[model samples]
Target: MTDSTAERRHELSSFLRARRERTSPSDVGLPGTPRRRTPGLRREELANLAGISTTWYTFLEQGRDVRPSLQVLTAIADALRLGEPERAHLIMIAADETHPGEDSEYLAPEVADVPKMVNPNPAYVTGSSYDLLAWNDAAVELFPGAIDAAKPNLARWIFTNPAARDALPDWPVVAQGLLARLRTNAGKHPGSPRFQRLERELRTSSPEAEAWWPRYDIATSQAGAKRVRSRSGQEQLMTYASFHVSDQPEQILTIYRPA
Candidate 1:
């Protein structure tokens, strides 16, 4: 197998292990044994619950050459009690298809002008890795140095930058959502070098990031209301929505308007 394929398989195995370890027999209405040595449900128990062979599940967890079908994946996801986003992430990780790397998508001219077009409203465009590609003047006003050419990562800025707490009054909620988005994207793009780099940086830079990374929470960007601390020291609520760029679905166009 190629390096990328191997990496994808390994990631799938790790994701499954993490999910399995977090779920307990009691959670799934299974009998709890007194002498159980495993922290969560055992591999064999999970396989049985999913109606698959224990040997097959073992091979899958071992990152062997066995490929699972969508039906099997669905069963396993149900057995593990995965949420919608988590199930989607699991399917992406387990797929054998070859996905495009970073070079496949580029910021088009029209796409670049989107943030500028949405004037007065705080707008920005970010890549799948949450790298800030473009931002409007309003976005900069709301977030000082948010449009900086250097240090433009949303995740890095949220976790490591002290000013983030001041800008985002609801820091805890926003941080969790960002982390969940990262987890979802990581599964979709398993071999992405940008993701690997950011993962390392987040895990090393902030204690909160390190603690939350293992939880494997997943989130998809959608329209939502956010509360921010304005320059006048007043709490301002803004509504935001994410738009997908043509041919570059990973390039996220986010626009924030007064709520």
Candidate 2:
């Protein structure tokens, strides 16, 4: 098998195991058992719930080369009670098709100009790996030196930069959410050298990153409110929304406004 294929399978296995281990029997309406070797539903129980053979499910969790139909995957997803982001990630990593924009590094000139158009709103655009591709003046003011770095990555900044911690009042919560989103992106682009390097860096440089990396949590960028400490030492609430760039789905444009 190709390296990317192997990496994807390994990730799929890990994801399934993590999700299964977190789901309790009571959560699935199964009677709680006091005597169990491990938490969550067993392989056989999950297979039965999804209406599949236990051996097949075992093979999947073992990272064997097995192709499951979408219907079967959907059944497993439903049985596991996966949220939207986690369910989408499961299906994406299981498919054999190559991801769009996986190999492309080109950013269109017009697309690069979008952040500037939303001036004064602290707008910025990031690639699939959360690398800063473009930003407005407001973004520069909001996140000093982040966009000016040789290779600025928002994930790296959130986890490793002291300035980020100082700026974000709820640093731990924000960091965890960003890491979860990064995990979701990693599912889409397995065996990517960029992601591998970033993960290694974060794991080495940040204790929280290392602690949370194995949890297999997944998230998507969505509208939310954030609390930030201004330069004047006053806490300010900001509302933010993220959008995928048209025809360039891998690029996300995010804008923030005062809440």
Candidate 3:
């Protein structure tokens, strides 16, 4: 009923609508509706599938005084075909019933489900915000002393850690790309604690990082063609590919192929 609450509800409504539209009828085992007025499920059909009343669903979507229950939120989330983050957003909104008039931040962690990277090619998959979630065997072997899953961070390794200076044959190329990409993440997630921690650690540990952290930018490591020097002193250049499992949007799968 408050302006901020109304605004957040409106935003949530728009998000739900957009996500619903993005899903096709076949995706949810629904028959295609040639005569359907909208591109996806109608509000009534969705409410029916969610087992909630049409009026309640409509009130929720309309940014009214509708306090959604966990069950109801789950139902709506499923009906809307929301991803985990989206589902989390719905849960947060529904669970905060006591504070009806207050707005909420619903951004789910971008790194919540990043895939476990493994294998012979040196590669890593980070969040859309560039938090290093996982890396492969080759990446570990090449970088040696870099990935401490206990402390796995690409930016920290490239900048703060000294091994990178020796591990990288072309430090500037690797370093620049990394810094630039991290700069980009910073811009998108300025208030992110994980990002702040990484930035703080880098600043305290590396001089180059301190200099670059302030120039926030928005870049992510996706598909990049690059090479590395193998332990045998041979240059092993390779192209890397990143995969985002459709079923697991939060997890990013990065695979490396030796070229």
Residue-pair clashes, model 1: 0
For each candidate, the alpha-carbon lDDT, in order, equals 0.86, 0.88, 0.61
- Name the TM-score of candidate 1: 0.92
Cα-based TM-score, every candidate: 0.92, 0.95, 0.49
In candidate 2, how many Å is residue 87 off? 1.7
Best by lDDT: 2
Please report how far candidate 3 places residue 126 from its true position, in Å.
2.3
- lDDT score, candidate 2: 0.88
Candidate 2: stretches off by over 4 Å: 99-104
Candidate order, TM-score descending:
2, 1, 3
Please identify model 1 stretches exceeding 4 Å from their true place: 34-36, 103-105, 149-151
What does candidate 1's lDDT look like per residue over 71-124, in tens digits?
Answer: 999999999999887888899889897554573246788888988998999998
| Model 2 C-alpha lDDT per residue in residues 1-259, reported as the tens digit of each score | 8888888888899899999999999889999888999889999999999999999999999999899899999999999999887888999999986543344366889988988898879998898889998889999878765776788889988888888988899999999998998888888888888888889999999999999988989988899999988767788899999998888786898999999
